[model samples]
Target: MARTVVPYSSLVANGSLAQPAGTTIDQSNGMYIAAARPELTILRVANTNGTDRVVTIKAGDNPPALAGGQGDLAVTVAATSGVQFIGPFESGRFIQADGTIEIDFAASFAGTITAFRVPRGT
Candidate 1:
């Protein structure tokens, strides 16, 4: 199955930014971000499940030899109302061949996920 795309919410420099409702966790197909500027991207995951959930950020496959060599990034979100922020990824490590970053959930995740990017020169 294809991965779900997570749209990025750009942050305003001197103004207030509206909060997004975010996308529901797609445990089955996983997720991806069309990362134009990976260094500025950030991912937010809110877990409301009763048990801890693991989220993995798949590494890049650019050099092949380095693919999976560095290992994927795994984050554990605490049970019930836990919120985690990940990213500002190093393009060399996480950007995929299709110019995106892939993300996966170890198991079913309960809650919403959002992606954010800081404006350049901010």
Candidate 2:
């Protein structure tokens, strides 16, 4: 069954989503769960050093997964060298690299990056 999600609101009036109790917010080896449906939301990742990064996201057990790409080619992100689209379904697989992906995204994105794995080839 699809898990019901709620709309995201600023509990502090700063337009920042509040972290749920017992939720992990570490950028290194951590994960971030966005609101039920994220509209006009952007997610970005940057390496602390000029090194390569590799990350992956396994599919969940839901539907209407996250969207990938931008504009015309704005399709679902499959897999890339340093960039990847997590997924829209409840379950999927994702792997991202930093040095490998230089121009994967067309639109500018900004969001909290949840890294649960150390960057490979760093």
Candidate 3:
């Protein structure tokens, strides 16, 4: 899977992402954020698969390696559905210092996740 620093406006703007389209993630490939870590307020996860999928999030810049059950919080998205984790969250809740904020999957599936932050640009 490919992951990069996408614009925080990607959620509000009605347009395509400057980054590449999202791919499948599972035991083999998982989403990783390492380039730039800024405090994010919104997290949108869209699952395009035929079956339901679970999205796992670990917040930190130097978090432990993925070994299943590494999620600080996990949310399940129904098949072909989407959900947004909105936040003007408590301090340290939505912030990622470096690349420590990791978003992963429990099973291989097709989906896209975009994060939005205030005064964007990292």
Candidate that scores best on TM-score = 1
> Which of the two, 1 or 2, has more lDDT?
1
Query: Candidate 3 residues 1-122, lDDT tens each?
Result: 45433334444344444643543344345655443343444566778778787876655432222232332666787787665453433224423555335566766656676655544443
Cα lDDT tens digits, model 1, 14-110, are: 7778889999999999999885467899889999899999999988876632444687899999999999998888877887777888899967688
Candidate 3: segments with Cα more than 4 A from true spot = 1-27, 35-38, 59-71, 86-98, 120-122
Q: Is candidate 1 or candidate 3 better by lDDT?
A: 1
- Residue range with the least summed lDDT across 10 consecutive positions in model 1: 62-71
Off by over 4 Å in 2: 1-28, 38-40, 62-122
- Cα lDDT for residue 64, model 1? 33
Candidates ranked, most accurate by lDDT first: 1, 3, 2
Give the CA lDDT, 0 to 100, for residue 45 in model 1. 96
Q: What's the best-to-worst order under TM-score?
A: 1, 3, 2
- Candidate 2 lDDT tens digits, 59-82: 222122222221112233322223
What TM-score, over all chains together, does every model reach? Answer: 0.91, 0.28, 0.55
RMSD of each: 1.9, 14.6, 6.3
